[model samples]
Target: MSSATRRPNTNCIHSGTRIDPAVGGVNTPIHMSSAYLQPNPQAPETCYPRYMNIPTQQAPADKIAALEHGEAGLVLATGLAAITIPILAMMRPGAHAVFQADLYGGTHHFILAEMERLGLAYTLVPETDPEAIAAAVRPGTTLVHLESPTNPTLKIIDLAATARAVKETNPDAVLCIDNTFATPMNQNPLDLGFDVVMHSGTKYLSGHSDLNCGAVVTSAARMKAIRETAVNIGTSLAPFDSYLLERSMKTLAVRMERHNANALAVAEYLERHPKIGAVHYPGLPSHPGHAAAARQMRGFGGMVSFELGDSPEAARAAVQRLSVIASAISLGGVESTITFPAETSHYKMTREERLAIGVTDTLARLSVGIEDVADLLEDLEGALAAL
Candidate 1:
C-alpha cells in the first residue's frame, strides 16, 4: 500500500513483513544461516552471502524502506555503522560536509576525528539556522547532515528549507536527516525533499533496546550504493539482530503513542514545577518549534530535557534518588532513562565546548517511556525533594 494511503499503525504493523507461504507463518522467519542454499542443478542462483537474495536482510530492509517512504533501504550492524557507511559510499577525498553543531556524541566524534583521519573536510553549523549552514558550505561540500529535535538539546531544524537551499546552490549535495528521534511514524524527511533518511534502529524503531541496527533508506540508486558499502565493509546486520529489531518495530505505533503522551505530561509537569529552571520538549507551548513540530510530526516524541535549579552535584544527587527512572545513556526503551549530557554524551567535548553548544552539567535529559505518568512524576518529585 502507498504510504500516503496507509494509516501509521497499519504501516508499522504490516509495512515490511509479508508472511512466507512456504513456511505458512504470519511473521518473517529468522533465517539464521549465514549462507543460503542454492537451488538444485546449480539453478538460476537461489541465494548466497555477501551479496543479495537473503530473506533475513531483505525482510527488514523492505520494511524500513516502506516505513520511511523511500524507494529502497539498507541495514547496518549498528547506528554508527549506518552513518559511516553512507559517508564512505558518497564521499570522496577532499570532499567537505556540513553538519549540525549538536549531534549524537558518537556521530560528532566520527566526523570531527575519524573523518579528519580519512582526510575529509567538515563544518559544524547551528542546524536551526539555514543561513549558517549555507555559509558553511564550501565549493567542495557534497553533504549536509542534520539531526532534528537534536539529542539532549531537542533543537529543531527546518528540514524542507535546508534541503531546498542545499539543492538549489549545490544540486549534487545530498541532504541526509537522522530520523531516529522522530521515527517514520512521525516524519518523512524524504517527502520533505531530503535526499536520504537515516535511522538509528537501536532507538525507537527497535523500541525494546534489545538490538543494535541502523538503516539508510533512499532512492533505489542510493540504496544500491549503500548496500555495496555495507556488505564490503562487513557492517551488515546479523539475521538474529534483524529479527529482534523487526519484532520490536511491529509495535512502533503503540509504543510511540505512549512515548509521546508520557513525554508531554512530563514536560508540562516539569514546566510548572517550582524547582525546574527550564524544560525542553517540543510539546511545551513555549518551545521554539512547537508549531513546526505539530506540522511535521504526529506526536512530540519520547525525549525531554530540563535544567535543574541547583548545581551539577545536586543534579547528580537528584538522579541518584530517582527509583523508577534509570540513570543511563541510551533511550527509547520500555522503561524511562535519564542522563547528564555533560558526563555521558558530551563529556568528550571540553567545558567551554559543551557550554558553547548549550550542553550544561545542569541539563538532565529524560527519555520518557511507556510507564505510568503518575509513578514517573512521583519518582521525579521525590528526587527533586532530595535535591
Candidate 2:
C-alpha cells in the first residue's frame, strides 16, 4: 500500500516487510553479515560494507519513510547523532541557526557544543512567541528549528503559523522539527511546512527501552544529503538495532492508544490532586496550548509534567516511593518512568535558566506507559501521599 492512502497501523506492519522469496516468511530476516560477495568482477551486485544495503536496514527505512509521509528516511546511531549530522551537512562555517530554547537537554548540549567548534552561530529564543523566533533570525541564519510540546514544560508552538513566518522571512532557510515527543502518529511536520523531520527512534518509535536509534525523514533531495553524511560519519544504525526498531514499530498504533489514555487519566488525576501546584499537559483543558494541540495532534501524547508544592528533596522522595514507576533519565518506554528535569535531563542548564524555562525543583516529568490506567494512578497517588 502507498503511504498516501494507507492507514497508520497498516503502515506500521507492512511498510518495512519483504516476504521471503523461497519460504514466504512474513518477517524480514536479519542480515547480520557486514559484507556481501559480488557475482563477477565486471558485473556485480552488492559487494561491500559501504555498498550493501541490508534487508534489515532498508526494509525499516522504507517503512519509516512511508509512515512519516516523507520521500526517504535515514537511520542513525542515536537521536543526537541523527540531529547533528544533518545540520552539519546543511550548514557552512559562519552559518547561523535560530531555535527554540526549550528542548531535550541532550540535544541542547550537542547544538551548543558543536556549533562552537564548527564556527556556526545560533540564537535560542522562547518558542511561545512567533515574533520572538522571527526576531532571533540573523542575516546569516540558514536554519530554523523547534520542538512542540517542548520538554518538561509542555508548551506548544504553532507549527503551521511558525513555518509560514519562517519561510516568508527567510525563504532560503530550512525549517526542521524534532518530532520525537509527538511522533508521526500525532503530527506530520512536513505537511505543516517543515523542510525536515527528525526523531529519537529510541523513544516511541522503538516502543521498547532496549534499542537506541534515531532517524531523519524528509524529501528525497534532503534525504540524499543526510544519507551521504550518515554513511561517511559512520553514524548509521547497526543492522540488529534497526531490526528491533522495526519490530517495535509494528505495535505503534495500539501502544499509542493506551499511552494517550493513560496520559489523559494521569494528567487529570494530577490536576485534581491537592499537592500539585500546576500540571502541564496538552490534553488538559487548562493547558495554554490545548487549542493548537487539538488542531495538530491526533492524540495529546504520553508525556506529562507537573509540579508539587514541596521542594526537590520531596520530589525525589515521591519518585523513590513509587511502587511500579521507575526513576530514570529516558522516556517513551513500555514501562512508566519518572525524572526530575532540573537534575536529570536539563542539569546542564544553570539554576536560573532552568527556573526560567519552568523546570523547577518541584517539577516531575512522567513518561506514561501502556500499563493499566488504574494501576498507574494508584501508584502515583501512593507516591504523592508519601511526599
lDDT of each: 0.84, 0.84
Clashing pairs in 1: 16-63
Root-mean-square deviation per candidate: 1.8, 1.7
- lDDT string, candidate 2, 208-229, tens digits: 8998988888899887777777
1-387 in candidate 1: lDDT tens per residue? 665578778877777775889878888887777656555865755665455357777777877887888888877788888788888888988788988878888888888788888888888885477667777777788888888888888887877777777776788888888989988877889989898888889989887868888988999988778788776788877878877777787898899889999999999999999889879898887999887787777788999999975798888888899999999888888899999999988888878878877898899999998999999999999999866
TM-score of model 1 relative to the true fold? 0.95
Stretch of 10 with least lDDT, candidate 2: 44-53
Native-to-model Cα distance after best TM-score fit, residue 293 in candidate 1, in Å:
1.7
Per-prediction TM-score: 0.95, 0.96
